[model samples]
Target chain A: MALARWPYDDLFRLFSGQAGPAPRETAGVFPPVNLYDDGSVFLVRTEIPGMDKTSIEVTTAGDQLTIRGERVVAPAEPGASYHRRECDGGQFRRTVTLPQPVDAEAIEATYKNGVLEVRLPRVPERKPRKIAVA
Target chain B: MGTQVQKTEAGTQNPEIQVREKQAVTREPGTWEGPYFEPRVDIYETADALTLMAEVPGAEAEDLQTDLKDNLLTVSAKVARVDPRWKPLYEEYSVGHYLRQFRLGEQIDQAKISANLKDGVLTLTLPKAAAAKPRRIKVTGG
Candidate 1:
């Protein structure tokens, strides 16, 4: 994905000068994704821990695949106080552009152990055809 | 602070999700194949126990290991490697194992510590020792 300048660049810059290792320099858009191609299918994998499967939504349109979800963190027990809070809770939507056309109708998604894997089968015509020389 | 800004921004229609890059942990002098990330965690304290919740996606229950030596508590997990048949085309995040350690501040009943893993999150409940629990004292009139 071409690095589209994040809209919050300026907002983050304002506090960048304050101190220590400005939030993971390599950090990219939320729900960081990894795409893998294995001849017949392209797999998209992302980690969204502690999220309910019902809250996640996956959609594919043309060459664009979108993943939208809400992660609701359980509230601390009454009278309990936090010593440290790092995990974030909220809504996240990430749309990834596919490198090649895919069979959207055959797309399959599975959520296991907080990880979401979306399998997009390559269109039949798009797959490399083996040719025999005359 | 930073968290406040994130909260407000998340309320917007197209909120930008903050993706904190995984922090790599240093290993001792030995043969270690893959990378290990320090999972982000939330630690909370109640009157009876101290709870720690950690995010370790892709980790299975059987692969998780937790150990307490002295006052140091360590949590680690082994994640299965990606299938060899698939070739990565575009990558934004790296997958590997998880490891993290923390030192205890309050006295804990180590024998009663319990851990549970569900949907890629590990929750550990560390019960506070009886002596460590605060007691209400009544004062008699002089």
Candidate 2:
């Protein structure tokens, strides 16, 4: 039997023989994300728990934004025994291609309560042109 | 109505039917804590293979124990909540015992069962016995 791994197949069928959503491939590290549009900007919220701010790195280029972070498993609590562990740790990366062009210079990111929110502002020049008809 | 709670010649009650009864009664205890605290689950089932999802959150590996006695499959786990110096603002979630019981029916291939957990999700795959699985006969060609 074959085992699933990172950078997995795009069109793989699960045990139910049902195909999952199309594979979203962009060169980078990041888990599933939600992007919201607020008319003039885009807000991307990513769930990254148990990670400190120092371990995260963010950047925006053209219409593409990438967020990279790592969560190191702290030294086992003193006198702690292994039972069951269920949290996802280690390094994570995500690259998102926005639907509309964004102003790379004014992009902003904020982290709170283990969630990373990235905001991409729209360009002043492309801010809905208005003119009088001759 | 389809539940097999009726008496049979074997004298003892069918465990699978009892488990279904218990599942229907409890529904989801401590469910009023809102929708965010959802415990991940995995289910494996078949026509005869009784399905069960083991929820053992906050329980260490060693504390969890699963045993089948007289057709009753009992799953028990314990979770201890330690409150440090920091006080909780609005704590609705509670940490306590995580236990569930099921009466398993025959035709369960318990020996070939598999369990694994990833990202807080626990999955158990229980394959059915040879006689329980749906099989098709091969036709011979001339």
Candidate 3:
């Protein structure tokens, strides 16, 4: 049995027969992310609620992708006091190294329901190619 | 006197942000088939009403459901699953539904309760009942 750091990771590993937990720490980082690869493209997703689209900035340089944004929470109404406060507002920046070089010009990003999805298409030469036998 | 709430000033050195992982809550058997997460919530009290804000990313507005029975309020959202073709390479967070329940301690006007979902945050305003609202009694000169 593999020692899984997270229950979801365990479930995925069980199905895929993969070993070892993710390399990065999941809890300490701001705006945790999920990265996926599908041969031709890679998808990066993050959840950042209550942020304006203009406030978010995404950029890619070589094999590194960076995401920066700020979340501004409105001050409490006058004469109002907090009973429970868990959500926070602040600035955050995260950078992840891609497994392979990508076509940065072709990348596309979309944000919906507070989820940001970035699609990075792999460079043509890096993609797997099929060969014919004579 | 009004309570003072500390605000994170802009342009100052920002504090390190920590990720808030979703928590699983115990439920009776034969409930929803898939696992659900407890969303983080903020509750504030004013003279007229109590406001609740919850973070439920990837949840559609139509998929959110809220129930108010007596003093117990339950909020739940069904998040759409990702496409199966994309193989997982690295994952730091899991996608799942959101569910949370709150037991109200004050009398709330059930009919006046209203909810709105924006940018994956659910805002609920629970107005206080007439008897629950604070009132000032005039002291006449003796």
Candidate 4:
């Protein structure tokens, strides 16, 4: 629950026995995310299927990275009855605090097959460096 | 196979089995009783088929499996762990197999089922059987 306010924080909470709210909220948000650090890059991935790429918005401010999007629920057919409904369909906003300073100009995000991956390259000064000794 | 179908049919009618059937549909960590984590899933029905979408990042197409036995459909995948070389400073997300099973009703045509994976989401299409689909009958002499 340390990063509870963030989007991918629930994923971290899972390991500590902290639970997220029960599913089945009528106005629930969609798309769960995964955040990670790989030496020189920070990776943020979100699951959002059937969404138009144009609708998603990614923005960075100071040390926070925000992902906002809308999941449009398919309209119900005239006589269709749901046997199971688990997908959340609506607008959602999730922001995570970056662990380290990132190169704003070097960040790149790519969306493919329902998964959006945002790569944030670490700033030169923040990256690990090897020192030479005499 | 016949007995399995009978069990499936019986399971649908029996309230107890229905409860257990849905009981296995737990997502994430807290609610489930076992160590195995259930994949995030979304099941939707169209006019001809039911589309099941699951979020399983890190899983490649080759690592996924979709099995149909009796009236149960099981989707499972093996997600490889991150590179051991890199030490995790802030850790989250589990690395293991993603699993989930659903009891398919008589409406589904098991023979025509298909699946495909893109990025990380797995999509399965279960086409409805002819008898299960809505039909409009017309009187020839009317």
Candidate 5:
């Protein structure tokens, strides 16, 4: 799938100032996603492990697809202290602009084993007609 | 740590292994220097072993490597590159190598380490050493 660089990435970085050889990828985002286009449809797969199915929401509007979800952080066991807290749980929103015009009604989405996959079929190209001799 | 002297028929030899222990994971913000993304991990401690679950999306099972040496454990995995035919349009997640490490305690049995990858999640089980397990002794009335 054709993915334009998230325009706000640089702006967010400006304030985050987490600059270095490494970028803070998950400082705010919850689920990481992979998007691709194969000349027919744009496919998106996101990793949302241990998330309830009902919390996820997928929507499309004005050539843009938005995925919003919330991941609840599980309560710690009694008398337990965390040694490491790398994973994060909270509400996350990701909106991607479509590379080409697509049939909005033909979109298909599925979630399995904590991975969410969405397929957006491109609208068919119109054939050019030959002009009659004048 | 200095090596212990072992007496043997064929002269004295120092077979004692020298092990360096790193401190346990602490909540020291900004301790991670350099430029590298930290993969998310979940640690579960049980009576038998400590289970570690790391999220390494887009990584293949064969491409992951778990190494342990001198009480320092490292987990690294190579994330497969995207298809060259499709150009990046809008990207929120940067695809690159996944690297994370931990310093295991002496209570762990390094010999029985096990790892498995499924649905982009890597699960590692570090069994506890026999001496680390809790034991109950019977007491008789004196």
Candidate 6:
């Protein structure tokens, strides 16, 4: 007999009820995500918990961006224990595909408050202009 | 916020117990505690650049420090939990240390990294390097 293995993505899919619209039974997904455009770069932000500053990894490929990290909820020192479990603890992989071609050479990502943010720069374009004298 | 939460190492336990323990474990409203912790953050994107705002309700300027190293952004802050100035019979918020990490992309200019804190909110701005700016290139053909 083999035990089942589950990651945070699976848990998120389950929480989102994407597998089947069963009205998600478990608590909501951890680290909600937000995407925004900064004219120059597209920004993606995610919420992650109990993670060290060193555990996070950010990389990009063409139009795709990925953020991988682990969340260790365990603390070295202890004061009080858990009364409720709203926060999720474990590893998280968040990848975002850009809508258009982006400058892989000029991407940026930042993390704070257990949240990871990635910024992808847009590729420059060329245009034709028409000039006329008044 | 001044309640104590006990850890249950047992394999099988009630879910309600886990939930209550997390909340009652501390005596502060805006503090970080326990193994499973999450912080709500707001990301603001503009044409020029992007700004990340975090709610560190009671954290002071000096207590917070941010660094962007090797494309990884790290934020660490500590709050003094005990102060004898006022006597408190009850507390709903507990102050503790906070540390968070982020993996970054290349768009962030390694040189101009700046951070500012105001009204319990920490804002970090990542500027685009000059080389990355979009510019028109003239084309000539024979």
**How well is each residue in A11-128 modelled by candidate 4, as lDDT tens digits?**
4564466755322111122344455666788887655655678988999887778787766656555555566665556556666677668998888998875567788988877467
Model 4 scores what on Cα lDDT? 0.63
Which stretches of model 4 miss by more than 4 angstroms?
A1-35, A126-134, B1-36, B44-48, B118-120, B130-142
Rate residue A63 of model 5 by lDDT.
75
**What ordering of candidates by lDDT runs from best to worst?**
3, 1, 5, 4, 6, 2
| 10 residues in a row with least lDDT, candidate 5 chain B | B14-23
Q: What is the C-alpha lDDT of each candidate?
A: 0.81, 0.49, 0.82, 0.63, 0.64, 0.51
Residues A1-134, model 6: lDDT tens digits: 01112234533664466644212121222233444454556666544433576788887776766666655443312332222233334555555555568888787776654445566778986577788978
lDDT of 3 by residue, A5-80 (tens): 2345544674577746443447356788888877899999999988889899999888888888878887779889
What lDDT would candidate 2 get against the real structure?
A: 0.49
TM-scores for every candidate against the unseen true structure: 0.83, 0.41, 0.83, 0.61, 0.62, 0.37
Winner on lDDT between 4 and 6 is 4
- Please report the TM-score between candidate 4 and the true structure: 0.61
The native-contact fractions of the candidates, in order shown, are 0.74, 0.00, 0.75, 0.24, 0.17, 0.00
Each candidate's iRMS in angstroms? 7.2, 17.9, 3.8, 10.6, 13.1, 18.9
- Tens digits of per-residue lDDT, candidate 6, B10-93, equal 662321112111122133333444321223345544444555655554456788878787778877666544334322211212
* Poorest lDDT segment (10 consecutive residues) of candidate 4 chain B: B14-23
Candidate 5: tens digits of C-alpha lDDT, residues B54-124? 76656678878888887788887766555676533334456555677788764889889999876566788
lDDT of 1 by residue, B11-62 (tens): 4664445788888877652124688899999999999999999999999999
Q: Give the better candidate number (2 or 4) by DockQ.
A: 4
Model 3: CAPRI class: acceptable
What ranges in model 3 sit over 4 Å off?
A1-27, A126-134, B1-11, B140-142
Each prediction's DockQ?
A: 0.36, 0.02, 0.47, 0.12, 0.08, 0.01
